[model samples]
Target: EEDQGLRFLQAGTALGTHKGMIKIPVWDCKKNQQASCDLSHRKNMEPVPENDTGQPEWDEESDYRACTYCKDNASEYLKHYRIASWFELIEKTENLASHMIQRAAAFSMQYNGGNLQLMCYPRFTATVDDLMSDLDELEGNLGFVPDLIILDYADILLESGNDERERLDRIWKKMAGMAGKRKVLVVTASQGTRKSLMSKSIKTDQVAEDIRKLAHIDLGIGLNQFVKEDERDERKAMIMRLSVMVKRHGETPSEECFVLQNLGLGQPAMDTYSFLRELADSWALLILTLIFLGVIGWAYRPGSRALHDDAADVPFRNEDPEQSRPEQSRPEQSRNDHARQDGACK
Candidate 1:
């Protein structure tokens, strides 16, 4: 299984707190084919072809039904997804949102859908055929045929001890094979060379093993973002601006696109919280009114009256004989001491 556990203690609590602070409400109508105000949850889940709109069709047969109904867990009907990981340096992205997040183009890694299966492969010894055999077993047993496959590190598939470039060449071809044979989209990652790390953007020439590795890819986008020392501290670096390095079809626009992200919340850039700004705008007056009322109530609460009265009298405490009685001897003692000092000086 792909371990969703975090490394540090209280990580989950900290992340939960962060998520609570960001109040991005996902309405059910937007997530379903039915626009419902009072929609109920569906019991059973089944696999279905998903459209790119990111909404869930709760009823597999209800595509014709109105999507205007607000779905409670509209996204709950997706196919059983399992996170399968192998003994490799890389990780796989199983969903379109995650795929785009890694590439820096999308948002939201919610937990309600898809079973992610993480399969561990032997280090630098397994072959693509061995991978196919395991996948075949997975399908035959679990009835889980993936539409997408992510190979954490292809270098582990074969001996990486010799012919680095040629090994990369073989590795990419094998990835292509997995895609074609399984009829699924295969995704993997490649790190940049040391020189490329220093550069603001990684170029095709900087691809570690072989630039030709991209030759087999349908679309390739280079990752880049603002990483000034100050910006890194502010986490503005999560605002990713990606450059399209290669595209199999269509013109590659020179213009770039950005996705503002906060992974601490386990969310990609969900509309960059632009929708949140709209929400605030729509409800600003009410929100402000409630806040004002709360402050007023806190200030005028029953106990606060006595507290404020005591504070108001603090400046005039010396005028009240009863209040000053406890300290009446201090000044006389100080004066007597000063007189004694004066006499001694004389």
Candidate 2:
């Protein structure tokens, strides 16, 4: 019932195709689970029939609701969503033999795991145009653009021992340009150690205020605070705050938001678990195969034994006919003698 339709201006294939070309909204704010639906079909659908009085047949609010797959649908809802971790993102998008090319390709959003919604970039290295071009290609390829973007492991970019600050500036400028075009709204999820350029250069309470002033959502998160064992209470509060902030930024709260954490449960764990599951499944298959073989053997063994017993009990065919011939000859012999005596008397 959750409306899995896109909000669009028109009806039919033309509208769907147009909406498809637009950036897919991203729910990059910090949350464990969220989703967005393409309500274009439903939104563009003709209003239901009205009575002779010319009033709506059903109340719009009560008639429409979220669909069953609302959560799953949210994963790909963004025009471009960020990879949760740099290492994992790099491992998936980067080729060890051709790391640079692969990184470039990833930044361009060329890797297609058809089912996955999130994409990653190694720390920001390219210029604003370079980043936008990459975003453009990703949107074109994925058929959607993320409304939300995250700068992953941003601490490295800021403190890589070089003039990382300038590099950071270029990234922000690119984001500002994109926002101006309404192509995207950016948020950076990073550790508290590195100061953000948005804050330092602008001299604001929070680094994101500049982007916020430009009508975009800007956010900062401390990895330490997010990763603590005793911070559930704080984390819950933070998530609620993020939801509100994202909504206030003119982004559909469910579409543009992000929650980032380095819980040490990255791709390795995912791969290991996948491998273990496959192993368990193979073992189960082998056991089932053996059981089937045993069943086949058990069913045939009785039939084989019965055939052998029947062969042993059966009399020899040639011997049976010879034994029956003598018994038959005795009766004929008496009839012949009686016929000879009657002839002699005649």
Best by lDDT: 1
lDDT of 1 by residue, 1-346 (tens): 2233331211322232221123221211222322222325422133222345532323334333222121211133222211110110112223223333342211123321335555776577778878888889988888778777877777556745478888888878878877877788887777777776555566778888789888888888776553343222113324445677778899975655445554545555533322233334556788899999987776666645423555443432325434654654888989979998999999
Which regions in candidate 2 have their CA more than 4 angstroms from the true location?
1-124, 153-167, 194-346
The local distance difference test score of model 1 is 0.51
- Models 1 onward score TM values of 0.45, 0.26
Candidate 2 residue 106 Cα shift, in angstroms, is 22
Q: Measured by TM-score, how close is model 2 to the native structure?
A: 0.26
Question: What does candidate 2's lDDT look like per residue over 40-147, in tens digits?
Answer: 422212333334554222233333222222223433333222112111121222222334344435533543444224444444454446556777887698665766
lDDT at 7 for candidate 1?
Answer: 14
